[model samples]
Target: MIHETERTAAAYAAVLTTCGDRASAKALARALVERQLAACVQMLPIDSIYTWDGKIEEAAEILLICKIKRADYEAVEKAIRALHAYATPEIVMLPIAQGFGPYLAWIDSVTR
Candidate 1:
């Protein structure tokens, strides 16, 4: 039987990342979902301000929110790194503690 933690309400996680542009964001999202690494991906345009090379920089970016299963995290991370344009892409996973039952069931069914 799957452990309590492992089976907890059907694992769900969101990977957050910023891409250089909409094209890149779309490409990454398609790749992840096509590969079954993510059940769904949502992209949004946003402004980013950060320090790089000891200089403050501001630029427009695309934020990608990926819905994936916890079991596929390693593969997802590897795939994202392989496809990501950034040398160190911001790939963060946030667990879903609670969600709509039907949606959660769909997520579990779609991913491995």
Candidate 2:
């Protein structure tokens, strides 16, 4: 059965961000996990096309999906800004409405 909660304190989140290169992505992922700001960070290579400086651009990037506690979103965002090398980085959070109970509990155990 799918696990769901109405705790107002909705427990978990998946934060997304993209890094220009593999090295930076790995570094950021490591930092978040090491600091316990994220329970886990999954990285994937992707091609992106976006507009910047009034022009269209395309580039290869590494996408980092960070699993964290909902309450720590601000702190996680702050750390990303501090460590990220982008003039304006992509930082987005998706609420995890329902998840396996054990996995959600694990996220809680690892993150503050």
Candidate 3:
């Protein structure tokens, strides 16, 4: 059973970020897992339309959803910044409020 503390503690999180291309996205995903910062990273291709430098821009992007611990959020952001191609990358963290107990436990086991 999942406990209140487990459900509410900001420990479990999914960090989201975007890469300009597949190669970079794959590299970032591998690095995160290798460093034990993320237990898993799910990547998807996406089309992004946004404003930058006061102009609307569009590009093909790859989104990475990293399952990680809240404690590693800073490190994750730092890594993304270091490896990302964009001057300003999109790094967002969403807490995992509730999940399968076994899967959540696996995340804890795999991540430092």
Candidate 4:
């Protein structure tokens, strides 16, 4: 379990974003990490099937796994929204329970 202090100052959130293609994913990932809103962004290619406008849709999507502090969520969200191609992108956060001390420290250092 994560302590209160850790929760207040630090957190890990995976921001799910899907781009039209690989190029867009790369561009978004680079921007996020460069801005420091995210310590890291992992881009993954995935096939997705969903419903839109009462129709079934299937497309190739890219997932952006963003590692960031709790304090940075707002900034991260703003940046992603600005860069996203979709009018309303999927942006969600999940709290990290615990992490390795050294790596967590590194995450804190880089993000701060």
lDDT pick, better of 1 and 4: 1
In terms of lDDT, the best-performing candidate is 2
All predictions: root-mean-square deviation over Cα?
A: 2.7, 2.6, 1.8, 2.8
Cα-based lDDT for every prediction: 0.86, 0.90, 0.89, 0.80
Residue 17 C-alpha lDDT in model 1: 89
Give me the runs in candidate 1 sitting further than 4 Å from their true place.
Answer: 1-10
| Candidate 1 residue-wise lDDT, 6-98, digit = tens | 454457788898899999999999999888888899999999999988999999999999989878889989999999999989999888766
lDDT of 3 by residue, 1-112 (tens): 7584576466688999999899999999999999999999999999999999999999999999999988889998998899888898999999987778778778889988
In model 2, the number of clashes is 0
> What would the TM-scores of all predictions be?
0.89, 0.92, 0.92, 0.87
Q: Which ten residues in a row have the lowest lDDT in candidate 4?
A: 2-11
For 35-109, candidate 2 gives per-residue lDDT tens digits of 999999999999999999999999999999999988899999999999998989999999987777777778878
lDDT, residue 91, model 3: 95
lDDT (0-100) at residue 40 of candidate 4? 85
> After superposing candidate 2, which stretches have Cα over 4 Å from the reference?
1-4, 7-9
Root-mean-square deviation of candidate 4 = 2.8
